[model samples]
Target: MKAGFVIEEHVVVYCDGCGDHYSEKDNESICFHSIAQAIAYFSAHSATVGWVYDGDRILCDGCIATLHCLQYGHTYPDTWQTTVWPLGKLTRSRSCAECGIPEIEAQS
Candidate 1:
C-alpha cells in the first residue's frame, strides 16, 4: 500500500493539474506515481471506481480513467462524448474493463 511505503506527513499526494493522486518520493515524475496510488485508492474506495492520468499531476480517479484511455484507447455508446469534456470527463461509472471508458450515464 501507498507506493510500497507508509502514509505520512511527507508522503505528498494529489496532483492539481488533473486531480490524479499519488505518493511523493520527492521526484519529478509525480504523475506516474500518483496514478498508481489513484488506482489503489479508488479500488479500495469504490469497487467500480478506478484511476487514470494525463501525463501531469492529477489525482482524480476520473482523470486516471481518461489517461488509461489516452495511452490505450476506448469506446462507448457513440453519443457519450456529447455531454462530457474530452480528457476531463471520466467514465460515468464502471467503463469497459478493457477500455476504461465510462458508460454514458455511469459514474467512475
Candidate 2:
C-alpha cells in the first residue's frame, strides 16, 4: 500500500502530471505533496468546505491554498449562511407537529 505524507510548513510542491487534483488555473498537474500541504492548512483552521474526486485507481488532490485568508480577518463561522430557525425552540410550548391538543408548558 502507498503511504500518505503529512505536509510541512511553507514548502513548494510540483505536479507530476497525474492530474487527479489538477486544475487548469494551476496550469499543470496536481501532486501528492501540494495536496498534503493544502489539507494540513485547511484542517488546522475551522472551515466549511467541499471537494470532488476524479480518475480511477489513481489519486490526486488540491486545496483553496490560502494560508492566512481567514486569519486576515473574516467575519463569523463557516456555516453562518446555513440559516437555522428558532421558531419551535421554546421548551414544551405547544410547538410540536404531533401535539395537536396543545402544550401546557414544560414547567407544568
Candidate 3:
C-alpha cells in the first residue's frame, strides 16, 4: 500500500491601492481555488464588485476611478459655478473644465 498527502491551493487577491486583501463581513479573506476561477468571478461581477482586476493590478473601485481621473481629469464640486434663484431654485454649470468635460445641475 502507498500513502500520499493531499495539498490544497488557494489564491488570495490583494488591492494594489490599499494593500489589503479582499475580505468578507467576518474579515475572512476571499480566496479562490485557481487563478482562472478568480479571473472569471471578477469578470462576471465587474459591475457590482467593489474591486477590479485591471490587467496588471488589482484595485478597489475608488482607487481605479481615481487613477483614471488622474490620467484623464475630473471635475470638482468647488470648481462648479452655482447660482441661486429667488424661487429657492439652484443651478450649477461648468463647461469644458480642465477635464474638457461639461456639467450642469438644476435643483428646485
Candidate 4:
C-alpha cells in the first residue's frame, strides 16, 4: 500500500526597494509557512539587519543606504588617494567631506 502525504503552499516576501528576497539558504528566496510566520520573521530580523519591513513594503540594507545617500548625497573629497599594491592592484580611499564617512574602492 502507498502512503498519502500533503503538499502545502507558502508565501515568499520580496524587498520593495530592490525586488530581492531573503533566503536563509542563500540559494533561493525564503518561503514562509504562512503570512504570520513571514511577519514574525521580519519583525525579529529587520531592525537588527537594517531591513525595513512595514507590513506592506520591505527594504534591504543596501537599498536603505543607497536611498540615504541619494537623498543627502555622499560628500567624498574632490580627489581620492590612490595606493598601488605589490601585486599591481590599485585602491582608492577618501573621507566624505560632510559626514566624514570613509570609503575605499578597488580598481580593475
Best-performing candidate as measured by TM-score: 4
- The TM-score obtained by model 4 is 0.60
Q: How far does residue 5 in candidate 3 sit from its true spot (Å)?
A: 13
Residue 44 Cα positional deviation in candidate 3, in Å, after optimal superposition = 0.7
**Better candidate by lDDT, 3 or 4:** 4
TM-score for candidate 2, residues paired by index: 0.17
Write model 4 residue lDDT over 4-76, tens digit each, in one string: 8967699987778888777756548888899899888889988776677787878877677777777899877
Residue 60 CA error for candidate 4 (Å)? 1.3
TM value for model 3: 0.53
Candidate 3 residue-wise lDDT, 1-108, digit = tens: 546986767998878897877775787888899988988888888678778876777787667666777887775556778889897899988764343455778965
What range of 10 consecutive residues in model 2 has the weakest lDDT sum? Answer: 51-60
List of clashing residue pairs for candidate 2: none
Ranking, TM-score, top scorer first: 4, 3, 1, 2
Candidate 2, 11-90: lDDT as tens digits: 33333334333333545533435555655643553233222223212222322222123334322222212222376333
- As for TM-score, the candidate ahead, 3 or 4, is 4
Candidate numbers, best lDDT first, in rank order: 4, 3, 1, 2
- Could you tell me which 10 consecutive residues in candidate 3 have the lowest summed lDDT? 95-104
How much lDDT does candidate 3 score?
0.76
Against the hidden reference, what TM-scores do the models get? 0.27, 0.17, 0.53, 0.60
lDDT score of model 1?
0.50
The parts of candidate 2 lying over 4 Å away from their true place are: 1-20, 24-65, 75-87, 90-108
Cα deviation at 16, candidate 3, in Å, is: 2.6
